[model samples]
Target chain A: MPPTPRRGASAVLLPRLGSLVVLIAGWQAAAWFAGSRLLPGPAAVAAGIGEALVHGEMAMHLSATLARVAAAFALAMAFGTSLGYAMGRSDRFDRVADPWLVLLLNLPALVVIVLAYVWFGLTEAAAVGAVALNKIPNTVVVVREGARALDPGLDEVARAYRFGTWKRLRHVVLPQLGPYLAAAARSGLSLVWKIVLVVELLGRSNGVGFEIGTYFQLFDVRMILAYALAFVVIMLLVETLVLQPVERRAGRWRQRHA
Target chain B: MLELDIRRKEYRGVSSPLLAVRDLKLCLEAGRFGAVLGESGCGKSTALRILAGLDPDYEGEVRRPGEGRLGIVFQEPRLLPWRTVEQNVRLALPQPLEGRDLAPLFASLGLAEHRDRHPGELSLGLARRAALARAFAVEPDLLLLDEPFVSLDPATAGRLRGELADLVARSRATTLMVTHDEEEALALADTVFVLSPRPARLLGEVTLDRPRGARDAGWVAERRREIERLRAG
Candidate 1:
């Protein structure tokens, strides 16, 4: 017989917790040998986290970082999906845009960020726009493949039924593209998070990246670890709570069919 | 009613333009059932696509009803795997069939219990029935079936063919089915147009004068021999 749902849940959860415990134990062992200032134990970092939370500094910096991530992710996904879909559908558009896409994809993220800062000044628009620009090419590539992989057999079904533009998009095109969209979202989120940190570290005044930079200057290792750990935890939560659920839902049809 | 006079259709092969269909002409009066019988890859499907207004690049004058709707059953089911069977059928309806009792249609197709199931959950026979259901749900003026029962087992194919004949009779839509199966063409169609291999042109057309219900296995066997004799000549 197959495992019951409750038993299955425990089977998945226990190993994850076991890995976390093992990682913390190793970190603590290393910290003890290195001593406190050079490398704090997990307990010292936990204390630093508690201090920052109590002072409300962690909340401000975390929220600021999250806001940047959200803005950049939305911008990249919207523009990239449209551009990619257009390029995929039309041969003329694809030919014209192909070289530019290749160039954008190969362009260094750091270079784009620096150029944005220099051209637009050290503003929020520059920071978010630069991060979005860096991430757009990846989203475009993923979504373009999705659009290209659309089944022509299904396209005939649409044409036979005389499906209008909206209906075709909803029933035929989008459902086929669901997996690719989910892929774009998942990769795009991870890419945007990393770039947003770089953007903040380079120019921003008040985010986890800026806080980490400040801690680095003072050589406050515990506070730096604390902020890093907190941000990691928050991102993990978003992945599990928001992104995974959406992906699972989008792909539920496949699971059921399989 | 439908009329097709396809002059030519060519595919860009590695070295030359491979012609698939040439000078293929046929006409079907309204409420008549017809089948284009040909070998696989003989452009039968390409001909159907032209009639259905899907392939406009061909040189042809296809005179179908100006404002009529089309319901096509592809060689494969071509169902949206993500949509439930009923959802797939509902999507093909020309207008919102609000408060409509689709249970009867599903029951007739032997799909009543599987309406909520996705297409992948069903067997090949059941999936074809779902495709048939989707086509009939629209009450289409022209119904196109491209080898609807080609890949099924013998018994399943026989049963589904019977169900299809019954549905087509009731709907009375001007139907055009393409099949390589001579038996299937003779069994279901009022008129059968035999087609040649590549650059498919009409070989001949046979109009079965006898009603479908009166034609049994013995009659079909006799007709098959007659068609073979005709082909030889």
Candidate 2:
């Protein structure tokens, strides 16, 4: 191929146009072969999505699901970073926490969610807590390793200068751990959201996960596809608009520092 | 003055103690620069760690003056990868220094503009300079340096030595450095102590009465040969 399109023509516009063309072609073919009930043609699914939007059901569902994911992700970030930092800093802390981490990390997410629901009686707290608990162990493992890998020379220099705890954290610890934390956060968000969906499907009644289960029971394939499409689009939007920017900045830091 | 008395260190999985500095009593005078020169694994780095209060598990007693602080510069710049040059330098400073202290330190080390740049962005020379600034910023009573300029080009190392010597002279900080480089040991130190290999024992100490920054190439060269012979044996 001749050098791929440059700047204005190739970089921004072409890929999106190609994707649109492929999507439309796929939709028309599916609609023709599968008929509307088992697989709503693309146009029908789009119409169902519009209908869901106007009726406000999709918005309510999306907001509910998002609230659960956000709550769990926040909890994971706060607890994971602190616990990981502590474990990394002291061998005593590491020894005490290490076994518990292994236990939690190996346990199945479904088992925890089911147990949490049984214990807490299917409340929203149980749902969110399940997701948070599922994520913490994994995040802790990542952050701990990052912290452990810090250059001892940096710590010695910190001591020589007599840096206080807060200064050392800001200058030495945080920067060293930033990329690792970012990676943890990104991966955590993806995992926690999926886990939250499972939690909602099993125990909660108002989120996207609940809606998917509800539609599936009624054999409403169009509704199922609509909700699934909405989720995929939302995920793509978040990765592109949010997680990727942070990852890029951290990656640039790693390129220079590591 | 600071002193170390008969230090011994043993590592795991070794047949015997890895380093034994027998009767290693030495008093580094206040406001004087000294070098500990020996071959690799000669316990020189280990000695600097003891003086810096890093390795406290050893058997000997290390007595540093209580009034003045101690600053250490490692063989590596050891700047935190995630930190900017300014941040790395600031790591040792208790709090941000005001006017005279901050400005002079950065300018002296030629790191004024590169302050906001991270260690990843710096050249080997610049990183070492930042390390130098970090040491100076501590404003220590005693400065312990473990060949902090080992990776720099000759010109850069020479310039840094001059700047560091000047800084030590101005601050009147007692200094102890360990270096395998004979010329670096001769150029920067007022007193040089040579150590025997492995089970390190202090063989002899040479005192240089030359004024700071005044030693000519010939004088440094002559001392370098003597130290080289001492190390070679």
Candidate 3:
């Protein structure tokens, strides 16, 4: 237990940073053996990233992808949470919506994207809609579980205190479901961002996915790696900056079991 | 004033429809404190729920002056575990504090220090105190408490009972409490309504003639015996 990790700046970062450095070194060595064309090294990819930012369409493509992710993530979470809460609280609603939920959850993402394009004629709405449609069912399932586990006694107290629908939702229901909503958001962000790529590749243009698709046809490995790496780094920043903070805030009331 | 006339209340059970309350009638005039004393599972809580408007399927009528305003303490401290103690109490008020200072209420209940703590961080006794604070925050015209003191150690229960008695006397809300503890009923209530076993009806009643201040231990013991005799008769 010499390296017993305590909560501090160094303790958390040291191990993760160590492993990541090792991974990059390993990849660099592999690239040297394979030659730069087949599997480019870290330096080549880094140079390619610098090149894209300086003289390429990286900004426009990155913004397009980011906007789609933000729009679709917000849309899915709002609609799914309401639907899930309704299903969880009402047996009749569950019965009516269960089959539909099952169908949507099992539907493949590629199929949804293709169907949306066919129906909407390859518009921006079609791309975001397809991505959100793929995501809504997952959010519904998680939030439904959260709603079902809610305490009946608390509901009684809310009713007795004469809390209006909106008040009860904010003070009573939302706090109870905060963790669930966070769970949905975390998963939805990952899913929506990845699917947005496939969506852009399939029908839409002017996104990271479209650029990657163009490079794939031209057989440009370095540019492809650069775009993919940049997107992954952006997502990592979001996970740290946005989602993690929200999850922590939502669980602030949890008591440590002695 | 508050009135309840629960002719019948039934629950859909496995074997058959289980009757929980029948022919149970209670009336507490404005500014009076009343207790319903009954055996365990004698449907006392069902009667209280009907009165609090928490249960709607009961076959009866409940008449109170204000329909929307209510203050209740359930058998368990049904606090929103995520909220701080003060937030739980404040949420029960007709408005957010209603422009009245709650510092006195918080101080008198010995919860001034613990007001910002969540219910999850509290012991049962402290949670019960928070529950009592919530019930009294509204200065409710009718206060319904369903065994608010159950499951606490005797010392904490007694302390809470004392604080409750003081608050009830000062607030003068028409209070109705349900409990199986006979002495507790005798100690605090102006009228203790004794109830029979299942599908409960009124077996008898013991009414105290003195104000709460004069009702010492000796007097409470005497009334307890009187209630026993009345129940036997």
Better TM-score candidate (2, 3) = 3
- DockQ metric for all predictions: 0.78, 0.64, 0.69
For candidate 3, please provide the TM-score of chain A on its own. Answer: 0.95
Candidate 3 regions with alpha-carbon error over 4 angstroms:
A1-6, A255-258, B66-68, B216-218
**Model 1 chain A: which ten-residue window has the lowest total lDDT?**
A1-10
Per-residue lDDT for A1-258 in model 2, tens only? 143344775678789989999988988897899775887788888898899999859989988998898899999988999999899879999999999999999999999999999999899888988899999998899999998998787787777667788887877777788878988988998898889879989998898899989988999988888887887688778888988897777566565544
Candidates' lDDT values, in order?
A: 0.89, 0.82, 0.89
Per-residue lDDT over B34-117 for candidate 1, one digit per residue giving the tens place of the 0 to 100 score: 999888999999999888888888887988753567878987898999899999988877766534678989999999999998
Question: Model 1: what TM-score?
Answer: 0.95
- The TM-scores, one per candidate, come to 0.95, 0.88, 0.96
Error of 2 at A7 (Å): 6.5
- What is the per-residue lDDT of model 3 for residues A1-258, given as tens digits with 9 covering 90 to 100? 143344899888999999999999999999989875969999999999999999988988998999999999989998999999999999999999999999999999999999899989889999999999999999999999999999889999989888889889998899889989988898889999999999999987799999999999999999999999999999999999989988888787773322
- Chain B TM-score by candidate, in order shown: 0.94, 0.89, 0.94
Report i-RMS for every model.
0.9, 2.1, 1.4
What's the distance in Å from true for residue A11, model 2? 1.3
In terms of TM-score, the best-performing candidate is 3
Error of 2 at A56 (Å): 3.5
